[model samples]
Target: MQKFPAVLSVALLLAGCAMSSTQFDATREALRGSPPLRQQAIADCTANQARRSLQARQDAARVMNVSVRAMPRTICTRLVAGWSSGRLSYDDYRSAMVGSMTPNTVRIIQGR
Candidate 1:
């Protein structure tokens, strides 16, 4: 029983490490449809990701018996700014999303 719990915890932790390539491919396909649509899609995707992260934080806090607080509003601001300024390519944005969580966020999620 102890070994099972340890193994399961490791699996879950690794699962959150990064996004899969398939996810990036799908995003790329969606972005390729129309030149004008790219901006809207990117904005929407970023917003969705932020919202999901907030929700996940809340859920983790509850599971860990910790107090829930608002996440920083600027979490996705840098990403959007970089994208808007052409400082970030689609590949860079995708990789950023996959590795978006900060060390603090990871610590909270792991209940450390």
Candidate 2:
């Protein structure tokens, strides 16, 4: 049926939205350990985030894509706190990190 194509397309789009392994590893490393370690990780994360965001932006432009305009600076206090305090599991935190940094999420935040 015609609906099959639409359903499959939606599935593929969602699957493509996952964060890459490099981002996952960096975040995992940053989430654990002492305050000083976290501080250093935050610095590294922000720098990497900026570079990756720029590359993503340029790639999207080249592809004439509108789905993801950017990757926000993902190192934030709330995420760190949640992860540090065990309020959020590593997987959940990773999902939240990706969700929070989406272009749509940024739009919502800015509008509020």
Candidate 3:
């Protein structure tokens, strides 16, 4: 009875070590098998999408008498988030900028 706790503790420690080693080997094999070219392609696609989103927001701001440089963080965040999610249409984007602007604000940027 006195040795039971010590035996159980040793068993548990060995099991934990074995599990960790299995996980490490699996991780190493997965990394070795993955194609780095595929990872680079995915990264490039993500960056291109981000650039398109930013351009859309700037275009919207120009049409609405809104200053793109002076835009609130919330507006930019919403633009990117909504655009990426497809929650906001091109028309919706145009409407939001126009709707949010003050009536007296003259549109400095032409061609809405």
Candidate 4:
């Protein structure tokens, strides 16, 4: 029974790590063609950032056992705009979106 729990934990962790790149690839594939479609996706994604931010905050709060403040409106706007204007690839845009929601991820990306 004890070994089973340890095995399950390791399996779950590895599963999560494996899915990370897969999710990114899937997003990129979905946005592969059609600049107009990509633009529309960026527009829609930008509009939804606020909600995503709020959800991220709530999730973090739950995990850290602390109260979380409301997410600000300006999160990820520049990156989304870059994607909207064709200045960023889909992968970069998706990374920015993820960074906007996760402070740790942003910090890591910023090398801070």
Best-matching candidate per lDDT: 1
- Candidate 3's residue-wise lDDT over 1-112, tens digit each? 1111111122112112323434534433443355563243334433432344455546544444456543333233333333333443334323323333222111211211
Best by TM-score: 2
Cα error of candidate 4 at position 108, Å: 12
lDDT of 4 by residue, 1-112 (tens): 0111111112112123424556544544554555665555545543443344455645533433344442212223333333334444434333333333234333321223
Which segments of candidate 3 are over 4 A away from where they belong? Answer: 1-71, 97-112
* lDDT order of candidates, top first: 1, 2, 4, 3
Provide TM-scores for the models: 0.28, 0.36, 0.23, 0.29
List the global CA lDDT of all models. Answer: 0.38, 0.37, 0.34, 0.36
Backbone clash count, each prediction separately: 0, 0, 0, 0
Clashing pairs in 4: none
Q: Comparing candidate 3 with candidate 4, which one achieves the higher lDDT?
A: 4
lDDT of 4 at 70: 23
Q: What is the lDDT of candidate 3?
A: 0.34
Better of 2 and 3 by TM-score: 2
RMSD of 2: 10.8
TM-score of 2: 0.36
